[model samples]
Target: MENRDVARLLRETARLLELRGENPFRVRAYEQAAEAIEQLDEPVAERVRQGTLTEVPGIGRGLAAQIQELVERGTSEMLERLRQELPPGLPELLTLKGLGPQRVRQLWQTLGIASLDDLEDALRDGRLNQLKGFGPRLHEQLLHALSLRRRYRALRLLAQVLPEAEALRERLRQQPGVIRVELAGAVRRLMEVVDRVELVVAGSAEAVQQVLPQLRQQSGLHGGMLLEGALPDGFPVRVALTTPDAFGTVLWWHTGSEAHCRTFVRTYGAPEPCPEEATIYEQAGLPFIPAELREDRGELEAAAHHALPALIELEDLRGVLHNHSTYSDGRNSLREMAEAACNRGFRYFGTGDHSQSLTIARGLSIAEVRRQQEEIQTLNEQFAARGFRILSGTECDILPDGSLDYPDDVLASFDYVVASVHTRLNMDEKTATERILRALRNPHVTILGHPTGRLLLRREGYPLDWPRIIDACATYRVALELNANPYRLDIDWRRVRDATAAGVPIVINPDAHAIDELDHVRWGVAAARKGWLTPEACLNARDLDELLAWLHQRRQSVQP
Candidate 1:
């Protein structure tokens, strides 16, 4: 079994247990185990085979045994028994944005609402609001959440699908007759969410035909047609079979926005055999456009003029930003995070613990903030001898009234501030835009965190006139963050070019809560590349001295 599959089963078990009124600690344990498995670099199945499953953090002997059973037998008896006890739709209800286990239980017991449709019916009939905690605001939000859920039902996060797609590509490459495999479509474009995985296989049609049956019978593949396949979970996979000579043409054709392909055809006629993608573009008398830029967004014209910007690379980043530690919701301590960042070749680390409004994250009190600052100062001194720096920062909340959570004096104490909206996310576009603008105007705010508050497929961001937000960031000289967490790659790539064009600097922040999460910067860099940002346009790509100087300059610009 894939680690993701095992993680999903464990998570499902936790949710089912919650629905059954199991002990809170037990539910939390399962949830933690699931998290540990999801973040695991090596497969749980491999660990099980090695008899080292218990060595994984959060996986005790009991959980390790369960994982081994699930991995070896392909099913967990405990999970199946829990499924038998709860209404099947009860698990689906837990997916709604605001519906926690307790709320789901209330709906089930108080109103017999076990499914989304049932909850919607209760809302329509005014029965839902009659419950103790249900209110008009939450009712409306739930409805919106359901709509978003339905709209994005088939889409999977890029992080989830990329690994699966790559694995399938590797398997295809191993097939006897497959010459080469290249990902195409939105997956190639590095879109944040994609509904299907598309690939092009280079080999003769006869060779492809010979290998087709064996390919379909591979593990994890359920149903497949001549050129289409499905995973056990029903994710669609589309493939184009072609000869090695036409590999580039096939890849280019399938890795397209219709407009891009049409423009290519109009400019250069139909695709013909070419050894590589660069050759096809060369034949068309244009520079080779990166796959991420093949979006029909004036890229062809730019390539024709040899004017494409050098996209930002992962190695261009010199520092890590907006990271959390034990001062807040983070699992790692300040020193550990700093050490990890340095080990990863970063010259500096910014500590952005939650500020006083997000109590659930253990937001720092004024006294706590001061203490953290002192700790950072000591660490900086210790690291200074080695030419490394740790910057004291805070992910300060932008309150409902558009004011910051910390007073001016308190905010000034930090080397940088990442102003973000942690609550009141349902505001209208104007209010949301204005609130963010007010925060941007704060001279101390170095970066705007996850500018839209989006959580990938889970919740839609508060609506905003993004063009205006970009203009404001530019005017205020504030850097907009491309939050690197897979769940919240906000300041979405689609809007990244707008920010870059407006001369707004983009900061690729992992927003990491743990040391391992620091690796999310790679995803952030990919998102930036998709948006056509170059190293020159990214704040994090600046060297330590240059970065600190820029921060000092921004602060001084606002001083009297």
Candidate 2:
């Protein structure tokens, strides 16, 4: 089994133990082991083979034995026993945002709410409302979570599914008689969440048919042309079979917004057999439109007038901002993260570790903040000789009343501050908007981080007057963050164009918690491109000197 698979089992075991009211230490042991395995650079299976699994930190002999069992048998007796002991769907309750093991236990024991369906039943019958701790706000939040769960149940985050999809596409390409393979649909459009992984395959019908049964949970081909199946992980996948001559037409048809395809047919007529995708656009008497902009969001009109945006690419970014380090909940230390950014050709790295209000992340206290800034100063001294610099920053919480976490003096000490809302997320639209507007008015808030706290496919962003928020950002000179964390790519791409058009610079922040996650900026860049962002409009696209000047200017503006 892969490390992630083993880690998942271990984590589920931890959660199950927590739900069962087992010893807290035992539960933490499992949780720590899972974290250790997940962060290992090498495979746990290999360590198990070497009989050195226990040598790894956090993996005791007892846990190693369980890991061995999981690796060899693809299942653990302990996990199976735990599963059998609980209601089969009890664990699924944890998938809801606010429902931790404690709350799930409360629901299960207090109201017999063991599953989403049971929770829904309780909500319908008003049993949930009668529960002691189920307040009106919690009730509304639960309803929203359930609604999001139902609406986005079929979709998967692009980052979560893209690697699997690409690997599957490559495997199909190696099949005998297959001529070519191109990914299409939402995957091609670079949508943050996708419902299906679609591909256009150039090959013989017989050759394509030969590979159908190999895939899991397949529906037989429709009209001997389209094959539908689930990837090994059960993400929905579809393949359109065509000859090399008609590859472009099939790809264009499958890689659609439905509206884009209909608009094209209405304006230019049905596409003819063309092997090149660009040729399809050329034949339509327009410039080649990028797949990311083919949402019928005026891309065709833009192309007609040669007005397509030279969308920002990943290479345009010269630094990373709003990142975490070991000073907070980040897995990597400050030096490690900064060095990793430097290795990736970034000239500057901004450490936006959690501020004091966020205890869950071990947010920095005043003393800790001073110590971290001293370390940053020391590191800057060493890095200066190497032409790299680390910026002292904080992901300062926007308090319930919309005030910044640190007082003005401490806030001014940082090179920049990413003001974000991390608590009291159930606010109504006007309240949320005003809360954010107040943060924007704070001169210390250099960038508005993840303008919405939405976790894609898991929870919807709380309601907000977005136009007002954008205008407030423009007026206050607060750059809006396109948070690069795949799950929370907030300041959603749909709103990015409006924000940028109103002269608000979009800062694509990885919100990186580890060295490896620094690459997450690519996903944010993809979403940014879809939003028509240009390098000139991207905050991190500025060079180190320009970034320093911008930060210094902001500080100056706030001065007496």
Candidate 3:
């Protein structure tokens, strides 16, 4: 198992133990082992393979055995047994933002509330007020948190769902007489989170009937031409069967946004059955609209006028930026990360390891920053012959009062700075906007990192004044970051168009903490495409020399 998976199980085990009122010492041990494993520079699986898991601090012999079992079996018997002993929905309650095991246990024991539904009923009936700390404010917060949890929990990230969808498609493609299988719904649009997996399958009647048995195994509801069900993992799925001649029309019906489909049907009678999707668009007297542009947000009007933009593609990126290394919280060393980036054909790589003030991430001290710069200079010399450059940068913290974590001199030493807010994320909208605006005015800040401070499916992005933030970036000549991490595709894609329209360039950053994470740039590119980003509007799309020239010009423009 990966270290993260291992750590997550250990942590959950600890929480479950706490919820069950188990021995305090045992719970602490699990918690400690989880923390140690999370911070390890190497994979726990490696240690398990080496038979040295017990050598790690806080990992006792018993804990090591459990971890070994977890790695080998993908689960723990003890955890399973414990889960069986508790209310099934109790573990889910722990996922709420402010509800801890202690509070959850209190609710369970005092009010007999085990599930979210039970909790909601209690909240409505005033039974939650019986607890010492369950006041009106806490009750209201729980209601809000519960709503968000339900909304997010129903959806899964694109990265998580796409592979499974593709596998399903391949499985169906193998069916005899199956002609085609095209993804539809949110998956086709590349939405960050998908509510369900929808597919359009064109095949002979016998082949389509064969597919029904597979859906039936999932306990799906099968109608005349539709099969709706969920994967074994409970992700909802639907399959619509069609003949080969009507494949294009069926795909269009499944793929277009509700609004876009409505507009199309109203403007040009219903689309006729055709073999090609492009033909449908042609019949409507409009150019073929890309799937990502089917949001009906002026896309139809734009297509009518032939003013569609050429969206940025994965191949358009010239450099990978805002990455981290072992100098901070990253697993890989500086040289390893740089070599990986160079091998990937990027002309340049920007290292934006966390700066001091974010201790949780092992943010770099000023001395370490200088040491890293020295290493970067040495690597540049070694890479010179290969036409590669390693740009020294920092993901500097934007302090609450609108000042950067580093002094002006320290910040200026780096080739660029990605100022981010790692703390004080609960500020009011006006305060948050002003804080980011102040950071934008800092000459050394080249990019605003993950401007929303959001973690998809977990935490909401702090509120912001988008128009003001976009205007400030345009005014300061600072680029905005589209952090490409699957968990945090912050600076939501919808706002990317706004910033770019205001002349602010969007820099698609992997925000990578390890070498493998550099590939996350593709996800950022997907989100950028949804925003109609173009190569000319993307900062990293520029070649190295052009990028350097722009950086130089930005510095000059901001200078007194």
Candidate 4:
């Protein structure tokens, strides 16, 4: 399989290990492995099959052997055994605040806790606070966790609206005097996810002008468009078309990162004499600013000084990273995932699944890890028969106490690693950052998956000092994962810009568990560009060889 898939498998394996009360260090190892794989350009499983697995580094004999077996089998027996040992829903418990592998295991062992509902009852009744390590403070946090979970469940995948946007585009095209119409804002850049859409119209005010009014006239349209007017600071949205003369200037100015845009205008004062955008920019003496950077950040200023580097584009990406399959709570198989990536014109695909400790997620164990690896290899062989590339990977869970899911030796088995937290979300800023920092030091950790564990509308992640996290990532040269999942756009857009400024490469990952989910990367990339990220700040934009070499550095034990 390819590096992307290898990274996914490592991550899932780690999460499963966490749910099972596996050694914290072990979980960290698996997570580190995932980080390494996510940054790898080549498929680790293929290397194993070619007797070159250890040649890439960190991979010791034990992990390499496990990977070899996974390349031959289709499942891992150890993971299955863990599932049987723990209550079927134990992994889901880990998602709550004040919860982790150890605590959850303790609750299950001592209080017979099996789900979030049971834990909530215990906390309300004061039973949970009586536990030796946990106190009232933690109990309160659990309540917040439940509340956050409810709020963060609904970040819709932006790609899901492409068809609707297209339909609207068609409707706009039929208008008179409409010379051109295209999506602007985040959607135009093919980002990993998005919220709303913006359309740029090229025509006189009269041409597309009718479109907005027509929308208002449509049955039920005016009511839907009405503002709630219920909040103290609620904003209203109005649709109208302006002349092309003012189109670019107005649209770009309004689209925002006011900081970025203010920098642009301040550095190059408003264009005088020319009412048209192109002429204004030409007079301003800067190459036309890309709409993506209209955020009014210092990008406009930097561009004037010829200091800003070329930005990355969607076409620069060679493969798909951070995906999952049926191996652990995913919805597709290795082969299916590979085909989808290939169809998207990607050079490789990463298939990550859950680790063994995540019982609720059906994580993998030692034996199952081998089987899954084998299955990945079998899929790769099948793909190869038709000239395709796939990678075996995993998304490993980061354990509490600053550790990963699997042993170092076992973790080094796959291609890369994507380290993330699946529990203990209530830890205060200090401990949470420390926990993640320790995992970053692992030679196998190549990337930190979703620095923030947030889920949009459902829950916020543990408090973190983002400025420190960005600095740490830069020091370690660990790629910061921009989880493109709509529900969990962690390493938020604003921070993404800061990360680029700090010299940490960003990987926009969909964290897709199904084949159709790969498209989520567009939203994240849109968010990234809005922050003025340059091409060099993104690992996924590099060529395969360059990507592999960079990833090897992360492993710290590899030379090839």
Candidate 5:
């Protein structure tokens, strides 16, 4: 597991332990581990392998041992024992923001609140507000947090977030001493939103002085704090700074976490946190970890011990597994969409338009599906003539009861099916998860399309235990579709490592209702790469024959 994955698990473990009323120190140990692992200069996997993981100050030998065990085995025996020891759904309680470990302990120990549902029940029955110290205001905030939990969470792209970062990058580009300039941070990481725009420039202050003042002049920041001791464009984004001593350091800091940098203080012995992040990491002795993994989730620990995984990249994608067309809610015809995919250099394109249930949006009927098949056949003919290929496909909906729109016979006609949840999305956890899980078992369903029916700013589709759903996908050989639409990048990029670690392959689908939507694949691609997706972990990265073979194997297994 990578640091982000480990950190997230640690946080969840803390929540579970808190809910079960486990020891406070043990809980704190997990939380502290999360914090320490996030800022390490190298991947922690390397550290455990080298037998020197405990050299990092925050984590003692026990925590380091836990990290080692987790990496070797897919999970920690300690975490599993906790699972057997706690309320079953207790860990999910952590995902509810505004509810800290202390409050969770209170509700679980005193009021028997183990999960979001139980907590909600207590709130609705007027039991939660009655608790000491958690009066009306805290109760109210808890409800708000619960509502947000049922909704989608996103971070905007850095460039889209920080406009000034762009201005500074241009100025740095013009400087002769500057060797390179690029926007880093959430912008480079491809987060949907961001707190700052990171601009990394390579140069001596003498070479960049002329360009530095131009960056500070622009507005909207904590007043050049990011740039204070460093490069000029650096300061005003989030922290301060306008100067960078070297391009490499800028690259490291710009790509790391705001919370993680604080770990460098002289806990036992070390230089004070340096003005530049490079000195801080270098003194500890290591290579830089990417900012995307800095969630206080053990990234630093992983880096300290060398535990980073090979990240996924755009080139890893050899095909387009999911995209829409004029057949359903899409904008272009099947041929047009296929041609678009071919232009982007994909080996195959799956035309996954909506299934029949979405009648209002003109989702395909059986007759219409047959017509689509004919058109796909024609397109395949032309593609062969031109040395390109298109695979017939459908984004079949997993109905409210867990059944796909079409029967196996109808589904059999297609090369692949991108099964998804579309309507009746507000079901409770059990119902939502089981419904999708049942659909995944359908013989024709090659992939589970956007497990969470989210539409970013529009609505949070439904609530389901994603950890459980991810496990189900792996058991069934069903890949989880990463709908790459800018607005609906569902099966979120943040969940990439978890999904991959579970032995599930991700298909980055630009769930394009239109041909232009195909381009938004870059956003999902960035999220995937940042999430540490490897080429093998992404099904779409495989060539057409490989994808077809996978489908054939899955399909035959479903048949008599």
Candidate 6:
């Protein structure tokens, strides 16, 4: 097995043990072993065969034995035994935000709620609230979680499915007659979540028949189906076999949204054989639409009018913002982060560590903030001759009462601020909207971070009237952050168009906690393209001088 596969098995084992109330240290050992194995350059199986698995940190004698068994036998008796003891669906409950092992165990032991169905039934019958820790707010949050889980039950994040899909495509390409392969469906559109992966392959029926048996032997493919099937791990996949002549037409049909395809058929009749997707669009008398804009959201008409915006590209960004350092919860030191940004060709870097209210993130105290600023000043001196800039910033939390974590004077001391809501996310629409509006009204607040507070597929963002919030952002001249963390690509792309149309600047920030995460800017750029954002609409797309000027202008305009 691959190192990733072994790591997954170990992590799953750890999670199951946690749910079963196993010894804390033992469970932690498995978790750490999984992480260590994942980071190893070589396969864990090779390490096991070398009799050096125990040399790896966190892999004790007992854990090494488990790894050996899993590698040699393809299964762990201990893991299987634990699975047999627990409810089959209990592991799925852990995927829900805020429902950790402790709460899941509480529900399982007290209410016999094992599956999502059982939990839903208990919630409807009012039995969920009878437990010790189930308060009214918790109950509401659980209901919201259940609703979101149901809506996205079969969907996996785009990042989670892309690697597997690419591997499958490569496997298919190796077949005797397969000439070309292209991924389609939600994956091609780069949706935040995908339900199934689709592929269009160009080949002959005879070649396809010859390759079907070989494909079945590959991992993740279900037997008994030649043209369509699901991964044994539950990822659905559909493969469309076509001739080279019809490949483009088939790909176009599969790539466009259902609504777009229907509209195309209505307007242009059935699609004709074309050499490429652009050919089909030209035949339909429309300009070529990008895959990201294929949603039936007026792209066809916009293309006909030749008015599509030149979407923002990754290279357009000049600096990184809302980044974390060791002064807060980030893993890297301030110099490390700044140097990494410079290495990535960024002209500047902004430090946005957590403020005092978010104790969980080890938020910086007032004194800590001053110390961090001093360190940033020192780092700036080191890079001064290099023409790279570092800006002092903070991710100051927006309290429940619509106040920032830092006072106005303290906030103004920074070059910029990213005000965000880190807690009390269960507020009503009115309260949530007002809370954000108040934060935006603060002249010291430069960018609003992850405006929705939603973790993709985990928790619903707090309720808010987005139009009102967008209007307030424009009125207050507060830039909205397109937080680039894949999990929290907040200020959702759908709302980005509204913000852009209203002339509110959008800032694409990795919200990077580690240097590697600086690459998340690519995902943010993809999301920005989907939102029809252009370089002109993004604040970070400006050069170092222009960015500094804009910051100075905003600060001067808002000065007391």
Among these predicted structures, which one has the highest TM-score? 3
TM-score quality measure for candidate 1:
0.83
Task: State TM-scores per candidate.
Answer: 0.83, 0.88, 0.93, 0.65, 0.64, 0.82
Task: Estimate, for each residue in 1-560, the C-alpha lDDT of model 5 and write its tens digit.
Answer: 77667767777677767766678888888887876665454567888889887887768888888888877885888789888987776666765645666777777778888888898889889987667887887788678877765543333434245456677688778888776667776665567656455665555445555765444323323212244233343333432233444444445445545555445332314334234555656676755656566555566777777876677777777877678776775646677778888888887887887888887557899999999889888878878966678888888888888998998889889988888877776688899888888887776778888778776654566788888888888877888888777667777777888988899989898877666777777777767766777788889888777877888887777664
- TM-score for candidate 4: 0.65
lDDT of 1 at 513: 84
Instruction: Indicate the TM-score of model 6.
Output: 0.82
Error of 1 at 293 (Å): 0.4
Which should have the higher lDDT, number 3 or number 4?
3
Per-residue lDDT of model 3, residues 121-190, tens digit only: 8988999877898888888888998889879879999989989998888888999888898998889999
Task: Report RMSD (Å) for each prediction in the order shown.
Answer: 6.0, 4.0, 2.9, 12.8, 21.2, 5.9
- For candidate 2, report its TM-score: 0.88
| By lDDT: ranked, best first | 3, 2, 1, 6, 5, 4
Candidate 5, poorest ten consecutive residues by summed lDDT: 216-225
Model 3 Cα RMSD, Å? 2.9
Model 1: per-residue Cα lDDT over 1-560, one tens digit each:
87768878888888899898999999999988987776565678789889997788888999999989888888799998998878888888888878999999999998899888898888888998779889888999898878887878889988889998888788778877778988998999898889988888875445554544323422211111237656668888777776677677778877877889899899888766775888888888888899988888889999888899999999999999899987887767899999999989899999999999898788999999999989989998899877789998999999998899999999999999999998988789999989988888888888999988989888888899888888988888899999999889988888888998899999999999888899998788878888999999999999999998999888888774
Model 2: per-residue Cα lDDT at residue 95: 92
lDDT (10s digit) by residue, model 2, range 371-450: 99999999999899878999989999999889989999999899999999999998889899989888888988899998
Instruction: Pick the winner on TM-score between candidates 3 and 5.
Output: 3
lDDT (CA) for every model shown? 0.86, 0.88, 0.89, 0.67, 0.71, 0.85
lDDT of candidate model 2 versus the reference: 0.88
- Which consecutive 10 residues in model 4 have the weakest lDDT in total? 222-231
Q: How much is the lDDT of residue 145 in candidate 5? A: 72
- Which TM-score value belongs to model 5? 0.64
